[model samples]
Target: MADEMFRAPVNRSMRTLDRNSFRKVIPLHAARVPENKNISKVRSELERSKDALHQDRLGSVFPDPDRDRAKSGTKCVLLRPGRRKEATETGDNPHDGAEVTSPPLYSSVLDALLEQNIIDLVPYSLYLDYSYWTYHDIISAILPEDELGEVPSGFSQVGHVAHLNLRDEYLKYKHLVGEVLIDKNPGVRTVINKIDDVGEENAFRTFRYEVLAGPDDLNVEISEEGCTFKFDYSKVYWNSRLNTEHRRLVSTFKEGEAICDVMAGIGPFAIPAGRKNIFVWANDLNPDSYTSLQDAIKRNKVTSYVQPFNEDGRSFIQDSAASLLTTTQT
Candidate 1:
C-alpha cells in the first residue's frame, strides 16, 4: 500500500548538491548488472516500479536560499533520489565492492540507473544520474592540455541559458566556454558570464551578464513535466532543472486542493498543478514573470484553476489567503 506523499514545501538548496553530501541507498534485493551502454533498457527498468517512493526522488534538486545568497549567477539544481530502507536481503551482487543485496524491484532499477550513468555510486544513496555532471567535468574535458592549469568547477543553467561566474583568468577563455557548453548540452543556445552581483532589488534575481556565444535572443520555451513555460531569460527567473520537483509537489495536492504560491515564477509549480484540476492562488512580484505566467496558464488551458496576482506575496497572503482560510475552515 502507498502512503500519502510528503506534502511540506522542500526548501532544498537548488544547484548546490554537494557530491559528498549524499551516500548510496542500497536496496534489499538485486538484479543482474545492467548493460551500462544501453540507457534505454535501464530507463525501462526504472519505470517498472509501481511504488512512487521507489521512483527516483532525485528528480527535483531545489536550491538553498541561504547558500545562494549574494550569488548572482543561476544555480544548477540536480535530481537526487529520496530515502530508502536499510534492511539487508539477497540478490545479484553489484560491482567489485558489493556486500549487501537489494530487493528484486529496486535491484533492477538501481542497476540499470548505474548503467546509464544516470546516477552516482555512493553508500546509503540510490543510483545517481550520470548525465548530470559537475561543471568541473565539462570544463576539464573541454580545456586544452596546453593551457596547463586547474579548471574552476562552477556553472549554473537557467532555462536554455548557461550562467558562469568566472575569475579574471577565465575571461580569455569565455568564448570557448560558451562553445563547449552549447556543443555538449542540447537546447542550450546561450552562454553568459555573470560580471556583477545581484542588486538589492533581487525580486527577479536578475543579474548583468556578458554574452559569450550563441544567439542573442533571451526568450525561450521550456517544457517540463507536461507543462510548457515561455519566458524571457534576461528578465525573469526560471529553473528547468526543477521539473521533477514541480511534478513531485503537484502530486501531493489532492484533487481540487487550493494552493497559494507566493513566489510563483512563471507558474512552474502553479500552472501544472492547476492543469491537474487543483485551484491555485499564485502571486509574483515581477511583472514580467507574472505576465509570462498568465500566458502559460492560458497556453496550458489552466486559467480556470489558476488566479494570477501581480501584487507582492506578503500582501497577497494578507489580502486573499486569510479570507480563503476562514471560508475553508467554516
Candidate 2:
C-alpha cells in the first residue's frame, strides 16, 4: 500500500491538475518547548535526533502563535511519523486506516530531553496541500504502481517551452504529465511531446510534436555563451544540452581564421565563433534553419563576420572552401 501521507489521489481520468484533490492532513509528534534563550539549543538537539522530521519544503520547527501555549511564547518542533506500534499503544494513531508504518525510532537524545523536562511530546496535525509535493512526488503518486519508478520527470527547457520525448507506454498520460510539469515549473508556459524520433521525419532533425499543455507557441529565445538565439522550435533543431559542445568547438576558432559550418542549425557554432571575430560561412539545407541562422547572426551583431547560406552540406563545403581560397589569395 502507498504511504497515505504523501500519496496523491490517483485519478487516471484527470486531464488537468485538481489541486484540491491532493490535500492531506497528517498527524505527527512534535516537541513543544517554551520560547527562551535555550530554545535554539533545544532545536539543535531535536534536529540531531533520529526522530526529527526531514522534508524538503516542510520545516522541522514551526511557531503556532494561535495555540494555547503561544501566550507564553512556545513553539512546536516536529518529528517524523511514528511507528504503528507507538501510535497504537498511545491510542493516538496517525495512520488510522493505513497498513504500512515508517521505521520506529529509538532516539536517545529525545529520551534524555524528555527525562529532563526540557521538552514534551504533543500530537500535531500537519496540513499538506498541492504545493507541498514536488514534480517527481506528484507524478510518481499519480502514475500506476508498476510505472511509479519510471515517472516522466525529465524534460528539456527552451525558454518558456518544455520539450519531452515520452515513451510509448506513457503516451496515454502525456497531457496529465505535461500539466503537472507546468504546475511545478515556473515560467514554463508551453509543453510539447515529440511524436517521432529525431531525423525520422526529416533530415533537418525536426520532429512532429503535439502540444500536451499550454499554448502551441514554438517561437523561443535562449541565451548561451553571451549570445542570444531565436528560432521556431518546431521548424528547426535546437538542444540546450549541446551548449557545452557548442562552446568547446567555438573556443577553438581563432579571431582571423575562416570556419565553415556545413550543417549549421540556428548558428550555434557559427554565431558564437563569429562573436569572437572568426569569419564563418554557415550553411543549412533546411530553409527554416537558414532563416533562423541569418536572424541569429543579425541578433548577435555578428553579420560582418558570419555569412548565412542555404545549400546542401556537400555543395556548401566545396563552394565555401573554394570561395575562402580565392578571397585569401586576393
Candidate 3:
C-alpha cells in the first residue's frame, strides 16, 4: 500500500506506481501512520501563505510585516480599514460619532514603518509650517541691504504670545549702560512711537509708567446698604481693563437699587456709582485699595450710600443675603 511504502522509506530505484494504484494503497496503511508526523511543516507553510495574504490585502506585492496591521504587536485601533484613506482625504469623520482625526501619519506608525521598511530605506526629515514676524527697523539694523533675509526675523510681533523670540541686535553703545535708567517716572505720559512699533500684520504695545502708584492700607466700613468692602491698589493697576467694564456696568443700574461691587479696585466704579444715588458695597482683595476707596468715598460725600468691606468677597457675599433684598413688608 502507498501508506505502507511511505513509512518504509522512499527509495529512488523503486518502481513508480500509477496515480490510481497509489490512491488505492494509501487507505490500506492509513491507520499505521502517526498523527503528529507532518504538522510542523504544514504550520510553517500555512504561516507563509498567511503573510502573503496579509501583504496582498495591504496592496503590496511583497509582504511587509511592519506596515501590515496583522503582524502588529500594538493593539489595532479597530476602524473600518478602507474608510481611513477616504476620511483622511476628505477631512470628514469616518466613524459617525465624536471621532477626531489624529495628526496625519502619527509618530507611532512612522516608527514602526522605519523599523520594518525594506532595503535601501533612508529616513526623511520632518517638515513644519510656521510664520515668523519681526520689526523692519530691527532687521534693517542687523544686516546690510545686500545681506537682507539672511538673518532670522528680528522679534515676535504677536501680542500675548507665551513663547517669544527676540533677535540679537548689535548694541555698540551699550558697554557703559548697566541699569542706566534710574528715575522710572510713572507720571510721564507715553507717546505712540515709544509705546509701540508699527509692523506688517501686527502692532506692539507697551506701558509707559510705573503703572502702580496708589495708597496701601485696608479700611472697612458698612455702607448704607450694609455690605463690606476692601480695596487693593496693586490689583487695580494690573486689572486696569476691568475698570472700564465696571464703569459701563454701573451705568446700567437703576437709581436707589442697592449694588455690591465684590472685588472692587480703588473705588473706580463704586465711588462713581455712589455719586449717582445708588447704594454701593465696594470690596477688594488688596488692603491698599480698601483705604483709598474709603477716602475717595468720604471725599465724594457719598457716605450715606457707599460702604467698604475689608473681608474676602466670599464671606461678605455669603453674609449679605438679608441686606441685599429690597422687598417691602406687605
Candidate 4:
C-alpha cells in the first residue's frame, strides 16, 4: 500500500527549505456538530473514540474557517485517515454523500453520535505545510532511500550550539542536516560536527570541529547544580552528559572537607562542591581549561573555597597531598 502520511520533499540540490514544496493535501473524515452547549460533550466522545485523528503538533478540532465564529456555532472534529468523497457540482461543499454508517473501527462512535443527534460526518481536506514535518521525518526523506533508516538525528547541545558527530557517509549532507536541526530546534543557533575524536590529538579532551551552520561563536554559559559556568566551548572540554556524575560526586563532599581535583576541567566538580563550603584545589594541565576554571570560580563567587591550579595530574596529586599534609602539621 502507498504511504498516506506526509513526507519531506526530496531535493538534495536545494540548500534551503522550499515551504511550498512541502505542502500536502490529504483527505480526512470530520464530524460537524452544532454550536450548542453539548458541543464539548460531542467533542469529548469523538476524541475518546479509536477513529479520532492523533497527530503530533496537530489539533483534532478546528473551527470552520468559512463561517464566522461569532455568527456560526458549528465546529469540525477531524477523524482518522479516510477516503475522500467526490465534490458536489459547485465544488464548494465536500460534505456530499456523508452517511451515518462508518468504518468498523468507528461504528461505536457513530452510534453514540447518532443517538445524540448532533453529528454529521464530512470529508475534509487537510493541508500540511513545511512546519508539519519533524526533524526525523525531513532528514529521513532527504537522505538516499537506502540510507533512510540510518538518518543522523542525535546531537549534543552545549548552550545554543548543537554538536553532531556525522559519520563518513553523512559528511556530504552535513550542511543540510545542520540547517534542518537549527530550524527544528528553536534554542539552537549554531551547529557543528566533530572532525576528530575527543583527546585524539591532545590530553585536554578537546577535539577539532567544523561549523556546519550558524555563527562560530563558541563562548557559552550553562548552569548546573545551582552553579553557573562560562567558558569557550571550542577551547575547553564540557560534556553535559556528565552532569549526573558531577552531581553524584559533589554530593559526597561535606562542608569544610578538602577536595584535590587533579583533572578538573572548567570547574564542573570544583565549583559545585565549593558552593557547599568545601575547599577544592582544582588543577588542569591545559592552559585554556585552567583559565576558564579560574574564571568560573570568580564568576560563581567561590574563589574563597575553590582554588585553581595549572599543572599535570601526575605532579598535582603529589604536590596537593604534600601541601595538605604540611597545612595539617602547621
Whichever of 1 and 2 has more lDDT, that candidate is 2
| lDDT over C-alpha atoms for residue 72 of model 4 | 75
Tell me the tens digit of each residue's lDDT in model 4 across 1-330: 115464555665555555566778877767777655656777787777756677778887776534564257567777777543433234244566443432354658766786777777777778887788898877776777777667898899998999999999888888889988998999999999999999895888899999999999888888889888788899889999999999999999898888799989999999999899988889999999999899889889998888899998888998897785565446
Candidate 4 stretches greater than 4 Å from native: 1-3, 9-16, 65-73, 83-108, 111-117, 325-330
What lDDT score belongs to each candidate, Candidate 1 first? 0.61, 0.83, 0.37, 0.80
- RMSD list, candidates in order: 19.8, 6.0, 29.9, 6.6
Model 4, residue 151: what's the lDDT?
88
TM-scores for candidates 1 onward, in order: 0.52, 0.83, 0.32, 0.85
Candidate 3 TM-score, C-alpha based:
0.32
Q: Per-residue alpha-carbon lDDT of model 1 for 1-330, expressed as tens digits?
A: 111221211213322223343223232222222233443443344445431224223442222222342154222222223336557754465555545744443444565565766544332222332233444444553445544385744567766777778878767767766765676678678988877776433757777788987887788887877888888878887655677788888889987677799889899889888878888888889999889998999999997789888997778878877765654456
lDDT of 1: 0.61
Q: Largest TM-score belongs to which candidate?
A: 4
Q: Please give the RMSD of candidate 1 to the true structure.
A: 19.8
Q: Which ten residues in a row have the lowest lDDT in candidate 2?
A: 83-92
Q: Candidate 2 lDDT, tens digit per residue, 87-190? A: 43322565675444444553778888889888877888888888888888777767778877678988999989999999988988888888989999997999
Q: Candidate 2 regions off by >4 Å?
A: 1-4, 9-16, 65-73, 84-108, 111-117, 200-203, 328-330
Query: On a 0 to 100 scale, what is the lDDT of residue 275 in model 3?
Result: 75
| Candidate 1 deviant stretches above 4 angstroms | 1-155, 198-201, 322-330
On TM-score, who's better, 1 or 4?
A: 4
Model 3 per-residue lDDT tens digits across residues 188-223: 221111122222222111222121112222122222
